[model samples]
Target: MTSPAPRDRVDELTVGSGARLEELVDRESLGQLATSFADLSGVGIRVFDAEGKLLADAAQPVELISYLSTLKHSRSAIESTVSSVKNLDPGPEGQAGIDGVSGGRYRVVALEHDGRRVGRLVIGPYFPPSLRDIPSQLLELEPALDLDRARQLLTMAPRVTDDSMDRLARHARAALDVVMFSGLRALLTGSMHLAAVRESYRELQSKQDKLQVAYDRLKELDRLKSNFLATVSHELRTPLTSIIGYSEMLLEGIAGEITGEQREFVTTIREKGEQLLTLIKGLLDLSKLESGTMSLRKATMEVAPLVRDVAQTMAPHAKKKGISLQAEVEAGLPALWADAERLRQVLLNLVENAIKFTSAAGSVKISARLSSLSTGGSADEGGLVLLGAQRTAVELRVADTGIGIPESERQRVFDAFYQVDSSSTREQGGTGLGLSIVKRLVEGHDGTVHVEANEPQGTAFVVAIPLKRATLRP
Candidate 1:
């Protein structure tokens, strides 16, 4: 696992009298500075914090120390020199102190931040270039000390002047400051990025909560609308049925002999009553379908006769509109498993709409065929089978050459009371519930219906009903 970040030390390094050098500069940068300076000036370097804790070091060669450790007196003196440098106090005017040891001298420079002492840098244990012979301290440390060998080892140590060592220490501190500044910049940038991301997440969550509340409100309103439609249609249907029955009686002369003009007026009243009754029935059917209470009497029946019957029933209406109505069924088409009455109602609605919308001299055609439909499913299965499978369905298309529905309005036309032309002076006369009821009835039979653009002109209503109940295939 990665190591945790260093303890927080901003206050210790930034503003207090007890500011620490190790807090101001990181350990990695300090070690690099010490190594670079020792290499450049040929001097041993070590770093310590205000608390006298050793942080980094690039000590001089081990050959001298290894040789001296063989004698107790020389080893003790060498360790004392290191301890003195580490424990040294900050000198006046940021100047370095040079102290002589048994073999050489150590230069201790105090480190400061904001005019306060924080740490120290020790660059020393280097020999003076003017040295002519082995030191007296090493010669007396052991009886086994070889004078010739000691002299040779002393030549191997780096020899530098006081001025050069002081310059090297300053360069090391300047380089470390740059590294510390870069590290602080990276930490601040990361904190800002984290805060921005959190804010965006909170805003997104707030929008989602609002959307959920709106969706729940729409659901409750829809339920209320369904109940209202069911109640109003039921109440209006009884009186409308009575009005239509009484008007039929007066027209047949059962109550009295009506005059010529009275007959025309009575006929208009019955016709208008019938129209109102049709609208009320549409509302009732729609409410039942929405509440999942509509019942269908399903059966397996031939498709050809049903198409021919719808065409025959609507043939007079098509003639009145001067539109040509035709029906075609593919030879040997399969029978459909569905509610015959409901299917007949679906055809009647499509054929009636096609005839009503087409202008004079226009054409409306009804066609059906037995076709294979590809339902969504995978081809291969290891143990579990995929969901949809290939099946045979009775496909029907009722197409017309009329003022075509615009692409944008085609889907909306299926919604109840949603009209392409809703203005008061609109030419077409429709309550707009016909197609909505037709859609619900078709889906109730496990069938699909959709409208598409007809070539050259007008719109086409396409429907597919499965020939048999859909099932998994091997």
Candidate 2:
């Protein structure tokens, strides 16, 4: 049978340590339990894992400590990548992956009971009262890491003379006895998390299999839709062409005299037919894009002209709404590797949205700038984020003075058939699929889109895409 748990450090660390019976717990419990031991013996207690990982260091300050949070987050990722890499061998010894060292400082001791290694405990680099500041000799830490909080925390560590080193060790052993009880609780929590992840993974795998089945069915349905559209469009064009010819003949008096109402109705029918054809063509284009059947005619075309063209085409629409449109495409802007027609469509859509949303006297602006594309490979030096490599990024922004979307709903707006207002029969007339299609098309070119609130009022859509070619300065 295990020995009984001790009430005080003097009773605990002696030969009676074997009887300690509290369950091992984690940071929270360890923090509370440390206070109990601290209150009893007046020694500032700290605990770290076997690898010197700080399990509970109530002595530290959060604001003054930098990179610790990042290190903590990276811990899980490091563990995952390490585990994956270590599975190369089938031997039992190959399973040892987790690192045993905490990166910089602190000392650790194995917490054991009944000859079983439970966890670990750590004491710190806190200065003895004799010293004024943290010693630069121990760990190569930055001076800023040594703050007033560190000074305060260090003062609390139990002070002793060299002769009583063994007693200090015994006291540490007693402190660990209290900590082991809490560590057991932490171990149970970790086990529960592992089980939850396994269950979630199993569920995800099942859902993925269902998605595969659904996707196969969708492919068949898409094929049928394509065939139906092709047949109907061909039949439709033949009748439409004949109707146009007959209407022209009637207008030229080839047929007998008709009433004014009859002529007006015929004219309306002809106009509606033409609109229907346009809608049908849009459908065909959208389908081809979705099916990966649309062929791109790639060319190195100057961007300035395209920007001007889009602005010009949409200028009439803007004029009708009394909105001022601005185009700030730079002179001698480098040629972009793009399909001219499709790029035109992309710009046109953005310009149309800008015009549609803006009120009279409000302005819509189109601007472009060249920048480094990679957000990841940048370093922060002197409080500025600068890119390591000179890769090309073209920034295209459509800023409008109109109603802007809220931050919470920005991403949801990109979803197909999603709109800001979903009230029954609202004023806005749209399929709510334009932005969705726009997002997909841009992503295909390895680009990103984000919406920002336009100053005062309105939304600014930022599009960042990597340039096909770049010229680095010597």
Q: Stretches of candidate 1 above 4 Å error? A: 1-165, 183-199, 245-269, 290-302, 337-339, 370-393, 440-448, 465-474
lDDT of 2: 0.59
TM-score of 2: 0.49
TM-score of model number 1: 0.67
RMSD of each: 7.3, 22.4
**Per-model lDDT:** 0.77, 0.59
Model 1 clash tally?
Answer: 0
Q: How close is every model to the real structure, measured as TM-score?
A: 0.67, 0.49
Top candidate on lDDT is 1
